[model samples]
Target: MHVRFTLQIFAVALLVSTTAARAGILRVYPGESIQAAIDAANPGDTILVEPGEYYEDAGSIYGLRITTDNLRLIGKSKNSHSHPSDKAGQMSNRVRLIANGAQETGVYVAPAGCEYKNSACAEELQGFYLRGFSVEGYPANGIQTRWVNGFQFVRNVSVNNLNNGIYPTLSANGLVRDNISYGSLDTAMWVAGSENIRVIGNELFGSVIGFEITVSNQVQASHNKIYDNTVGIGLFHPNGAGNPPLPVMENWVIEHNHIYDNNRPNDAPDGSFQADLPPGTGVLLMGVSNHVVGKNRVANNGFVGIGILGWCSATTGTDNSCETRPPISDPAANDNQISLNTLNGNGESPPGGILDFLAADLVYFQLEVTVGAGNCFKNNKPEGLTFVSSAPNGELPSDNC
Candidate 1:
């Protein structure tokens, strides 16, 4: 038998092997429409797609629109964890959802007329699972979900999506793991305005922000390889951004990840929120609170590593200062614990137009919104030729909470 048929059989066998095999199983062969299968599927049904390119029959705006809850969409992959540029000739054995220039999103997962922020949403998708596919070339987002309550994305590759690669916005109880995303105008994976989310074991690169936790709460990012982006990871709370700021960005745990060499130029549009990024930045904590950052390997970023600053004080190359437009509330970096991180070979040279004095392995700008309520750093070990660290806007945040 041909290896293709053998792989297909193996994939179907894995699908049916599940003990809780629910409802029914639908198969969409190559050249068949995924949307048709979705339309025909029930709420708890599972759909298996063959290893082929899906481009022509996609919807006008979305390549695949998933509105049903508890739906499982899986793909047959030769090797699920391999990248497209691998030397092995295995790229053709994976399911690929492609979008044309006119398309906006590759996979759009949200209920109809959903506005959970305004309480107008009728239903939120729950228990959705997607696995083992490649989504790319969409203008807006590759895999986008909003108002989703228990969703999981696993072992997927997202590439060259002009905007966000995998974006989970206004969601909760979500897990994004073992995914690869790269080459985006915006963030590779942005967990924005969401809660109870965990982003782990993903590789992100070549975007404005590799992985960002923006105005979110109770989220955690760990064991992800983030590199070659404008900023590796941004923990930001940007105020006056279209809508009212969400609840304080708090209760985050960032550790055990490798963030390095993120020196790409900022690709976000001018005057946008991320446009002011100076590049060579690793794990910036801005206007957030109650975070625990430790035990990560951050190296060779060339500008800063694990910097913590408040809203009004962190500025670079952007002439529009916070003095021009201050926030309603003091969005300071408060009550954070930065400890036990390893930094190496950072801040030999700052990026152009950035203040030369502000670059270091561990930077802390002490713009205290509330007196004595500040971040504390302790037991961080820096290693380099001359140890080009120990420079902060004030004294190192050690022993000063």
Candidate 2:
């Protein structure tokens, strides 16, 4: 009986090992392909890339693409060291994924050719972790993820990526932390069509919109330095020439961030969503709901420090109605609370042009299709001066919730 029990135990161990793919480390030194190593690794494996400049654009997809579940792609093993150049990847001690304009994206993580309704595909393709790499000069995004179930984007660098630096769309349950994104033609970090995501502890600059959250739900953005962009931290709901908007863009929290000096010229192409953005706007919440903006230091912006506008007024160029027309995205700011923020030295210099109405410390004047309710800004800095530089008739609420 004792011999039989020992045999049974050994048999169980063997079964367990075979059923679950054994995890291992795959290393790629200089001149080797990181994508090749990733292709060879199993689920739950870690790919360690050595410090060097790599110029591979993994055929038709990206520099590196990840599909295996629980895969961790790490470089340099430490994030304390940073890229020497801020706007472009001049050099770095970490692994550098150089696009050289041949690649559209640096790294992409998604389940390839998987049916959305398949349970097994969902189980097999989830959870990717990327850290410690400098991806630069991509014609498109430096890092892009779509439909990934869970992800951790930590300590990566993106420079001179044209459209977006780090863009995660249609993904869920992700944490984006400790990253640097700069010199994008559009937004630096764009979390669109995703849910349950947090963007924290990053530096975003030299873009049209620094950090933009669009068509998403349940996002928390905090502890970031957002500056030197056309607009800092845009909560937008896209309703034009894209996917269908999420219902109401609900449950967001923006807190404890140092948002200042976002006075850069708008370089986005015409007819783009951010092309009409007024430079020096601190935080613009457009036509979304259920937010708490508190405990942030918003300072030195040239335009409105905290601006709220219905979609119609900002985009349609009409001021009195929320656009009931077709493609009517939820353009009303509803059910938001703004309180206890340090607002100073803002809106002293208004960016001129067509958006001349957007110059103030706090503003809420929607001219088109306005049925917004339960929005108020209270307890901001300088005591009773919250409404001193607001829209006409103090439309930005001081205490009227």
Cα RMSD, each candidate: 8.0, 4.6
lDDT of 1 by residue, 1-401 (tens): 69999999998888877635657899998889888998888878999998888884533678888888888999887654555535242347778888864678888788866632344366778878999878878888889888889999998888888878999887789999999999888889988778899999999998999998866789988999999998999887556233345655678899999999988877787777778878889888877778988899988887888888776667522554566666655667778888888988777667876366777888777454453255678778853322222324445654454
lDDT of each: 0.79, 0.78
Question: How many clashing pairs per prediction, in order?
Answer: 0, 11
The alpha-carbon lDDT assigned to residue 305 of candidate 2 equals: 85
Give the poorly placed runs of model 1, Cα more than 4 Å off. Answer: 1-22, 56-59, 79-82, 85-91, 115-120, 240-243, 316-320, 368-372, 383-393, 399-401
TM-score of each model, paired residue for residue: 0.87, 0.87
For candidate 1, report its TM-score.
Answer: 0.87
